[model samples]
Target: MYRLMLHGGVHVLEGTFVNGAFHKPLFFFCQTTMSTETDETRQSLLLEQESRHTANQHTHTEGAKMPNRKGPSGASRLKKCIGLFFEILYWLLTLILVQFWKACTAVALSLMLTYWLWGGWATFCLMIAALIGIFYNLQDSVLYFPNEPESSRLYVPPATALGIPFEYVTITTPDKVHLSAVLFKQRAELAPGVPTIVFLHGNAGNIGHRYMNLHELYAMCGCNILAVDYRGYGKSEGVPSEEGLYVDAEAAVNYLHSRSDIDQSAIILFGRSLGGAVAVHIAAHRHNRDKLAGLILENTFTSIPDMGSVLFNLDFVRWMPLCLIKNKYFSIRKVSRIQVPTLFLSGSSDELVPPKMMQALFRICGAPSKQMARFEEGTHNETWRCRGYFSVIRQFTATVCRPGSNVMEPSPSPTPGPSLADYLGRVNMQHQDV
Candidate 1:
């Protein structure tokens, strides 16, 4: 059966037409032989349609003629105009429904949170006003959730829907857990032993959502980037845990190792968020530094406790005394052992993982080549601010991936995000001039 869709047409066919195809015409001979029961059914349908149409027209006429005269001398005409204005506004909002869902959700959630925090029905009475705010904002919430519209317009690949170029490969871990990953190769003009970078995605979402960043790295950085899905992420099999993800990472490494064309020494590990933990673990523990060229960590913390303290705004969490619990990505401990060159990047305004901790990790990394780039205004996951995301990465790849050219330089500090006062000040200044 074909789907009835909004853009295609409005199909309000009901009753008998619901299941069968109304568009299918009968052969001339078959039409002539059809029974009287069908004629009776058609007549009943036409009468129902006519009655509904007449009732709708009558309702419309009555509504058009009615007047809301609240008082004898009050501004009744003004009231009518205002009512009409709101009716038209409602219609427009209905037409553009998706854009306003987030604002609505935010207002509702805010009021709920406020009440939940405040307690008592007396203070909760203030929530009524928030319902009005929620009315407008709900539209924005809807817009954000359903397959972000802009990303939909991108060219996604077929083997997987994410649009990254791939050749299917299966890898077995040293412990023999099978894993799946897609390899994205660059159309290169480079020397034969070009560096290959394997991407380890942040914990949580899968690989499809990361194509925008991946597309840039492949096109500009010109590295053979293999973005692997951890266990239970994307199309990959098995459950995800600290140990499971590490096993997955090892499998991905061994897969790269099996390839004859890939230079073992030129392999670079690029990890984002939680992937940084895994990458640092592999780089530090596995005796493969001679075969590994470099490592890059973006928006990553030093240990889980450090990240937890940053998240909950408590320093004591970071001071936990456990052996495994001390390190965030545990990069701080491992960074000292990592002899390969490294690049660490963090956003200053990162609320989740504090930038200070990332900076601390940068200082601890004992690499012949090491650089820490700080984006002063960037939020968590926003690589866009750090030299278009691609530029800093390309520079890092060139510096660390090449054997003799172990270049490392300070990345420029990023521009700040606009403050609230700045926006209001501009508006106030404009009005004062008049």
Candidate 2:
């Protein structure tokens, strides 16, 4: 019998059981013609597949080898360079315009001086007009002294340098200005009821300059201190203005209210010099006036107009209209609106703000309770360094803010002192004797 089998796509014929008996060895014959045809077809198919694969690989390799022309081109680079050049040109033109304006101002002033010296009435009138205009435009710069000390603008030391535990905070005003502040907490664990002081510094320097004073206040009063740099001072953003400072103070107070660690009810506003005016503004207008524990004003002027009269001593300047005074911190007018307990820290020898100003404020204050402390040898800036300075503050805070109470206790009325009229009379007599 003969049988056919297929192997590897080729046909083979096999013979067995020859002559009615199975043969021990089987005989096989391959179909050579069919096998040859299948091998040729397979070889052709393999060659075609290899060619397709090689072609795809070559195409991919060529694509990868090609440079990416979609990247930044020469024209884009040139455009960027041109944009940079124009920006530099714009700044240069701006600087030149500023310098030219200054030069023109100088020449105009010189001509006005010459005409005035020669008794030219018409030119004198013109000079006065020019001066008024200049003053109106530059009043903000004149009133704010954030960079008076050169180092104030260049450097602000961290609160940690004084070995006090502090957190650097940024507060945002409603007007979108960012204020830099340092919150100094006690080294030991602080009670939730501990009073927090919002320290508003004077006009001249950043909060860093007040760190030593803050350290002393923190230790003596045993209160958390929040020292803030007003707008345009230190790392704060924006130019300083009278309204801006008021909003900044409000924002700080709101920030204290937001914190869980702070006692919002026992918050105190401490202001020195220009800061006193700010403190008065906030205390007068605070929506949560009942929550405020106290207000502390040190060596603070009564008003900008009063300061003008004292500082210039010129009849025209002294009588200048309030409308013409652009930056008017009229604290005297606002103090009567404050409902919180108040402390007036005065320096008798203060060369800047007269101690009489503090006295006048104390007399006018509408707080439930008020007290005045005078340091005889203290000057405007050194009052805090005087003995019993912190003691007075400690006593005042203790009286007003009771521990573990969210609502401040009503402080007892302060002991009566000399009347404002009597104080002024004594001051006048002293001056006359001098």
Candidate 3:
């Protein structure tokens, strides 16, 4: 038996040669002779014996000779001691790295759950790296928002014909964040006390990207809408922060409330993505029952941490630098305190913020007129543009999203998928129906 060190690690082997047969964990390029019964049998037996005796015995013998030359030298003893210390240290570090690998594995397993619900190429890349035992930097690889703002491909109506028109309105927060806004209302054709809503854009381009929502709420659903850009977005000035966004939302909502053309009794606040948390903040603290109507939250979650949990493999992060997330954007903590009708929208394929996290927000809401609708294939920003989202929002506006009334349709379960096979089957069924 022998213990060997190679390939930066250690291996143990035990072997024997008997009746010209070999057994060993080591391999060598030597030949051995065996008594011949037949040519094939003799060759096989000789190879087995050679394999059994295989090892770098030359190297071992050389080491043994060096010790013999030392002849009880303290230098030899010292060298042996140093070698032994390093061997133990190497193994200890390896063991620690192994434990780290497992911790990384646990974190990967948690992310697999989210990936299973909303499979994406990025998640697949991360998972593949994990399975290969690579020490991937989850924060550097995953928790980053891209540096440059993405350009939107849609048009911003020079004056969005939302109804009550002021020409390309410019509004400012008390803290001096300038928000460019457009308001729409029809007093007689649109009921004076009819539900009024505000549009909060996602963390992408300006209000132009939200035109589908604007057109639906304003022209089709017959609700007054005030859509504004947060700071650092669209024509809005100043950089955006969690608190700064709230101030922007407040400025826009207050702008509507102050308007004589738009009725305050029917005022509703709607937020998308980051805006959803902003809306919750307003509904929880700033909203007056006498002034505001209801709430609509689309593709939003409980908080930034709740979002981080969904977006990344979080177990390792539960103790890591994730603790430094100061801008909580925590809506779930505040939603239960809100006192109005609330409608929640979630997207089945929302990779940025999975649909399941919405359950936390729904669970905490205090309003009786709370409704949640999920678009089967919608991601974070486009839930309302999905097939059923427009109709759902329109219906919500007509019924539960009404002024001074906290009424809502039953929210669907927040579970995400049926399968790709299922989506294909439905498409074929729809063709048959046609």
Candidate 4:
């Protein structure tokens, strides 16, 4: 049966040609023995049938070797597209969930705060709003809040109301900012070794706001007093800044030094609150140290960031970076460089600047002699009202300064420090001459 199948007529003969083994003579012989068919028709039919059978067999073999290749290729491309879509969807969902979590946390915090402390929470919300506003408009916020900048016409200092005659003087800073100042002096001859107090007042009001302290210092101590208005505060030109205020202080010192009536060697820098930081900054300068007699700081904080923590008493702001605080009067760092004698007057009950910060400053002082006068019953603005305030100032000056003692002691070569202009130039603060 197998041999008969192999020899099975013309179909079996066609297989030889299809397999590429038929000689031309064998094919011609097979055609001639088969029939007298036309050569063209027989060749054409045989070639067509053989070509069709060869193609079908080749395709069947390929299909067997690589089953489902076309179907899987199309399916894989579809799978890739679906996977990319789902990946994008997952990230979108994650982003939405994160935003929703933040919102929920904020709402929960607000509700808890409102429940526990209604008034404080309201104030906190207001403060948050104010901070957001400040972040958006820092320049205007610094110009406006915490400081009351009024025109000179609005406030006038009483020069002679307390019988200690004071002269209204105008001075110019190195930056050419004009400042209004009051010079308080005894009409009578000043006692020997009596110091001139270059008073720098606190943050909020003009120098005239300290009339009580001025009157008391003059009547009680009989010392020379010169108080100047910082820029943007009580008739001074330009906006207020930490460096601008420092320059105003320097200008005040220069004005006092220029005066022949006032002794340069007996100049004492007296500052309260913000003024205290400015005074310390002035006294820390290598150029100003020789001319200064002594230093006095009352109710001043360590730094502006520390003061913010103290002021707000909030955990969130307690960790506020010092770089973010625009008005960074870092008195603690500056006080360690002050070479003169220092007197730190701390009110036990100071609401704004805590007594601990003052004590920290007192301990860090690098002065030859430093003392702290504690007012047990005093507060921030009323430390001068303490019974021994004037006496402490008088005694401190008498002990630290002497007549013709303007000569500075030979210390280590002083490191160069940043000038007021240099400090202000680095930040986003601009002050124009008026």
Best by TM-score: 2
Better of 2 and 4 by lDDT: 2
TM-score of 1: 0.54
Tell me the TM-score of model 3: 0.55
Q: Rank by lDDT, highest first.
A: 2, 4, 3, 1
Backbone clashes (count) for model 3: 5
Every model's TM-score: 0.54, 0.66, 0.55, 0.60
Ranking by TM-score: 2, 4, 3, 1
* Candidate that beats the other on TM-score, 2 or 3, i.e. the better one: 2
What local lDDT does model 2 show for residue 72? 95
Model 1 Cα lDDT, one tens digit per residue, 1-434: 12222222233332112235343221211122223336775577458655665665576579789987765555867898899999999999886655445445435555667788977685476566566556433422321121233342232234454344457766666666666677775433342356678899776555666766665565555667777877655556565567777788867876788787566667888887788888888887656676678888888878776666766689896776564241235667886777777877677778677777777777777777777666666677775434444556666677666564322232221223322222121110000000
lDDT of each: 0.62, 0.77, 0.63, 0.69
lDDT of 2 by residue, 1-434 (tens): 34454644455443345347644333344445454667676577447555655665576579789987898989989999999999999999999768545534444565576786786877777777766766776766667888978868768987766675788999999989999999987544453667889999999889988877776676666778899999999989998889999999989989998898877778899999999999999999858596578889999988988888788776576478887888889998999898888888888899988888988888888887888888887899998776677667776788788567432232221223222222221111110000
* Model 3 stretches with alpha carbons more than 4 Å out: 1-157, 160-166, 187-193, 316-323, 400-434
Compared with the true structure, the alpha-carbon lDDT of candidate 2 equals 0.77
Error of 2 at 280 (Å): 0.6
In terms of lDDT, which candidate is stronger, 1 or 4?
4
Decoy 4 TM-score against native? 0.60
Residue ranges of candidate 2 with Cα displaced over 4 Å: 1-130, 286-288, 402-434
